[model samples]
Target chain A: MLLKPKTSILQKIYLPDIIIGLWITIKNFFFGKKVTIQYPEERRNYSSRLRGMHYIKTINGVENCTACMLCPTVCPAECIHIVAGERPDKEKYPISFEVDVLRCCFCGMCEEACPKDAIKLSNIYEMSMLKRSVYEKDFLLEQRGHK
Target chain B: MDFIDWIILGIKIGALLIALLSVAPVMSWVERRGSALMQNRLGPNRVGPFGLIQPIADAVKFMFKEDPVPGHVSKFYYVLAPLIAFIPALTTFSVIPFASSIEVMGRVVRFQVADLNVGFLYIFAIAALGIYGVVVAGWASNNKYSLLGSVRSSSQMISYELSMGLSVIGVIMIFSSVNLNDIVRDQGNVLFHLGQFAIPKWGIFVQPLGFLIFLITVFAETNRLPFDLPEGDSEIIAGYHLEYGSMKFAMFMMAEYINMATVSGLLATLYFGGWQMLPGMHTLLESFSLSGSLSGITYEWVRIVFEMFSFVIKVAFFMWFFVWVRWTLPRFRFDQLMGFGWKVMFPLSLVNILLTGIFIKVM
Candidate 1:
């Protein structure tokens, strides 16, 4: 086998990728719309089916939660915690109930497992706080007009 | 100081400030838009009309973002580098003839900020000094990539500058004047006859090859397209500016656009007959009929304003052209790039000089 040294040297490296990449980019610049989305004021619309932050609701100044642990049992992230207490007046209903905001995975399984329509996923995704405790939104209904 | 001199000084200072400030942000938008257009896409349409507010948003982001300085950087020089980078970019614009002179408040106002006898040389010298900023900034960065980038930028500038300088030499030789204004005037006469049409003696016609060489060299020097290896983001991660943050980075951005403006101005002056209108446009405008408002300004002032607008339009076209080429051409490899510059561009420029000399001597 007789291979010329110059050809061998040339064949060792064919560095046309950079140039070709640029050409393609240049072609694309004239051909396609760039996908850098401007954020904030011009927001991307989320799909209706998109899962987001969990919100607990109650009507007639009562929480629908009955110290249920069924929803927490199915959560994968182990990001939820609950504490419950039996009501002194009503034997069937539990009085005290707590859900750790930090631990809750915002999964719809929690909403699905609720005996009543107590837990729901809201469209609100931007949830931030200065402290971990500040993220804790109390589930109790407002007494009169007070929160 | 005399009131008229004060007026001139005020005009000069004000014009510089406005031009310097406005061009930076506007060019950024132009770059993004031009790039998108070249790629057949709409870029940055959300902020303002055609993404005009993108620059503003970017400025705000820069302002609000926390300033970070690398601990490894040479603290003083790193901080000082951007100022050095930007100052020289504006230095060339001092000689750029944007319009003809006009009488303002009984005082004659020249379009340019300054017209040094060494106008052309001053531009070259100032432009050359800019490499120092890149070199220092790169070294001060104390990073391998930035150092490499700076070194590459300096070498590239030095190499292409030879060709660019030589190209200008031909123009200077042919015109027999280094004054930018005089060169434009020299090109006013008809170079060739084509029946009813007299081809204006533009530098493009006189030295087509030289003009091409000059254009290519300017592109390289300004680090736009095909020759943007210095800041090749994919590999180098913004190169010399990798460590910069806040306003420091903004200065570099400002410097690049200003360089674009400087080169555009130079190209307009050197090749496209500066602010001189094409013969047909001039004739049409002269014979035009438009209802005039009752303004006190004379015909000469209006003409000055008109000429200024033309200069701006020309510069803007070149700016867009830079972006167009940037999206059009692929970058050359390091060695191929060097070879093309030293081996190809250098020789071509030398040949251009010889040809120009022969043409000038014989014709």
Candidate 2:
């Protein structure tokens, strides 16, 4: 059962109430500060820890990744594929690294799992692509993200 | 008519047509921008400076778009309906006086297009014809939703029009004239006698209850929000104009906005002081003119321009009010709308008329 509230004579005549409503709207229209941030010209600051685009951290001339297979092991989507090979300077380095971007959920687990802090998820969220993209080793190493 | 008179009339008609045509698209921009302002956001600021030219761009886009008629619909009524809707909306402005009469080129020129004795009735009768367009479009569409929308619109408009018509009776009774020009001229009189404290006899002051009723019914008649059951997108999926596209759709939109403009014009002319300014404003302007900033014929021209400007401002205020109300109120349920119209609005209008009658007799 529904209880209908008894309306007073003043309430039944809705003009006064409508006037009050109008007053509130007019006040807001003229005085209330808008919250819109125009995109392209303006951007919101994301946290440093935001799980965005994947990037391979580099220092000096060499990549930080030693290809321990930890990122691939921990990746929930199993998107990461690495083929470890020996180099002159490094005992283990990835000869090939691939990440199927569509399959990856950007959970930052691979970043967490990387012992060398090599595979970092940087604060670069715009990842729209015309076609399906798989991140190659050279492609992932580009300075495309804010750390 | 003489050659000069015909030329003057031609100029007036051309100016009026252009003015009426431009109001709809400008209102479209204002509605978008104003609603955005109320909701705390920027709307359409890219097309031009504050998106002023956005409506022009929109019209251009509508022109280029392909208009495909559905195979199932009746072709004749489908084509005719938009013209039917648009013509009446445009024509209703003919009877409305924008300002008091002024002398121009040695001839007295009234601001209105046609000063028929049955001015208000002409407005009502022309406005009433708009329902036919909606009904015809809906029926011809061969779509159930469109039919339902048209039915709802027709019934709502028909119902609300009774109260709307009745509300105007009070104004007519008070003014003792159906000619809108006379009604406006009458409004320039002092409202009441109170030892050096005279009020302007605005229709709003004289018939507050009638004004309220008229305001409400205008919203319903225009099929605006809180009374937009006919075109409720969520329920009826654009109602009567569901199958329409491109220029046809644009015509319907133009018709709706022009209806809004007409209502705003009427509201300003009837309740507000029409072209008449606030009590001291005209005297202030006259005093300023006497101070010798402008002299002779230029002064008359200045006054005429100022009066026209004031009329535009009054109409614009009511147009802004329409947008403000649209953004503020939620749509009403059909049953509740009908109930309110009959139960509340109808009886209240009668009481107002009765009281107005008694007041007129006593005084």
Candidate 3:
């Protein structure tokens, strides 16, 4: 159904409507609150559950991973790689752990698949880089994750 | 003219040219920032101090950029069009008085470049000539859109000029002078005393309808938004200046802003008491009491400075008003623009003239 807007004589003349339009703009110009965040100086807070860059969880200078290879098996992108090895203090540890960050889908499935809660996603979203790089185990152990 | 008179004329011309030229860059910045503010966004604040130097940076970029001449365009006329458009826009300011005359060294020095007896008429004539540049650019570019833009521009200007001229007829009737300075001086007279306060007989009070018509027509004359059909970006893709780039395009942009400033000055001079002190300025000047303290030459200088300051303030307000209106109203459709110009503004201005004539005859 088509609807026709009712028009008055004053509306037809248009001068009053123009004046009202101008008044609205002037009010916005003088009193309206600006919505710009001035990006470099300010940043917006995101939800804690946001899946961003990946990190490895460590407690008391030891990783929570038992080298169970669960994360690599569950990752949809097949980006994660791990090699289990025996260490002097631990029965099992990963000698090599790598995440091909460029292939990351950020699904958070690897975090869920890890039985020991060793692999996790953080809220640090600024992951831009000049060169493409894979996240190595040493770099991932920097404790950059908030959760 | 004597040697001193020649020197004074040279100074006036130089000052006016400098001020007019600077208005383009300054207004570009103001338009960007003002529109941004109106829309609740911060525009171009990354350059020097709220983007004050942004236009200068843009000018430098224009200067350094490659100015390619398209092979399809007519070479001579294409190069000549911007100059034609620009010179007339700059020249229209000569007859407009910035402030009243000051007696310097026993010889009167006016704040105008040339005080022509037919001042406003000179403006209309020169402004009409600016349309040639648009038409020539459109034709010379050898493009359909450019030609269409030029055609629209010429017709729009011609249609609106009639009403613009007719609207000011009321002002001329009330002020009884063609000279802008004389008209401004006449506007300073008190219309009536109401208790302790008196209202100055500005052109607006006497010819409200004329003022309204003139204000609307000035928008059309300057080819501003709601009347900017010539450069309707969505329609014709920048219209006449589509083929122009680098400094040539800059020249057209400069011509537009300068024309805006010139017409804004004209609007203030005709309607709002040009060079007359604003409402509270008289009391402010009285409180200073500089006339009693300062000597003859000094007092005259002070008075001239104050008047010039008032004129600048009025012109600035109108310039900002143009920007305000531009951001507020959407562009008019081509048909709506033409219809409004002929059917509405034309008849309204005619009625304004008839009413003014009757009022003058009765009084």
Error of model 1, residue A2, in angstroms: 17
The sequence of per-residue lDDT tens digits that candidate 2 reaches over residues A15-99 is 6787888888778789979888998899987787788888898888688999999999999999999999999998999998899
In model 1, what is chain B's TM-score? Answer: 0.94
| Model 2 lDDT tens row, B1-363 | 799888877888899889888987899999999888888888889998999999999999999999999999999999998988989999998898987787877889888889999988999999999989899889989999999999999999988999999999999999999999999999989888789877789999989999999999999999999899999998999999988999999988999999988988899899997888756668878897889887777877777777788889989998888899998888999999999999988998999899899989987
DockQ for each model: 0.26, 0.74, 0.71
Give a tens-digit lDDT track for model 1, residues B164-211. 999888898888888888888788788989998889898899989889
iRMSD (1 decimal) for each model: 4.3, 0.8, 0.6
Q: What TM-score does each of the candidates earn? A: 0.77, 0.94, 0.89
Cα lDDT tens digits for candidate 3, B1-363:
988889888888888889988998899999998888899998889889888999899889999999998999999999999999999999998888888988866788888888899989999999999889899998899999999999999999989999999999999999889999999999899998989888899888898999999999889888898888889999999999999999999999999999988998898899989989888887767766654776567767777888889989989999998998999989998888899999999999999999999999998
Top DockQ prediction, candidate number: 2
Q: Could you say which candidate leads in lDDT?
A: 3
Please give the C-alpha DockQ score of model 3: 0.71
Q: For model 3 chain B, where is the 10-residue window of minimal lDDT? A: B287-296
**Model 3, runs deviating above 4 Å:** A1-4, A58-105, A116-118, A133-138, B70-72, B140-145, B283-291
